[model samples]
Target: MISIRLNGTEEQFPDGSTLAEVVQHITSATQGIAVAVDAQVIRRTEWASTALRPGAQVDVLTAVQGG
Candidate 1:
């Protein structure tokens, strides 16, 4: 298993996991969300090709509606 920091919390997953897997594991709704790895923004189209490394810092932000 590999360790990664997700939204400021340490989490573990099997090796060779992609960004898409993590995103799916975190939430079911994929819309209105942004993902970053090691402080770099990852485009939605590249999520499936992006792989996570041990100790990687992942940040996921969701859009909110406000006036």
Candidate 2:
């Protein structure tokens, strides 16, 4: 298993996990948020191809709706 930091919290997943997998781990409330890894914004199409490494830092940002 590999250890990764998600939005300042430590989490673990099996080795070779992809960014898509990370999205699945988050809650529905945060599912639509943007994801950044190691300071790089990740495109949705690349999520499945982006392999995560141990000690990686993932930041999830959500869009707020207001009128």
Candidate 3:
């Protein structure tokens, strides 16, 4: 098991889980969603290759229409 901070809350995931998998596990709506790891924004194309490390901070942000 691996520990990560998801949107400010501590969460656990299987070791070697990619960012893409994590996003899917959390939600199915992929459109307009952005991800950042350790305070760095990760490009959409890199999600599948990005691996979440223990103690890493992850932020999942979604776009809002009414701004």
- Cα lDDT of candidate 1 equals 0.94
Q: lDDT per model, in order? A: 0.94, 0.87, 0.90
Error in Å for residue 7 of model 3: 0.8
Clash totals in order = 0, 0, 0
Which candidate wins on TM-score?
1
Top of the candidates by lDDT:
1
Identify the superior model by lDDT, candidate 1 or candidate 2. Answer: 1
Q: For each candidate, give its TM-score against the true structure.
A: 0.92, 0.84, 0.90
lDDT of 2 by residue, 5-41 (tens): 9888999999999988887787455456788999999
Which candidate, 1 or 3, would have the higher lDDT against the true structure?
1
Candidate 2 residue spans exceeding 4 A from truth: 29-31, 65-67
How high a TM-score does candidate 3 get? 0.90
The candidate, 1 or 2, that scores higher on TM-score is 1
In candidate 1, which residue ranges exceed 4 Å CA deviation?
Answer: 65-67
* Model 1 Cα lDDT, one tens digit per residue, 1-67: 9999999999999999999999998988778999999999999999999999999999989978878
lDDT of 1 at 37: 98
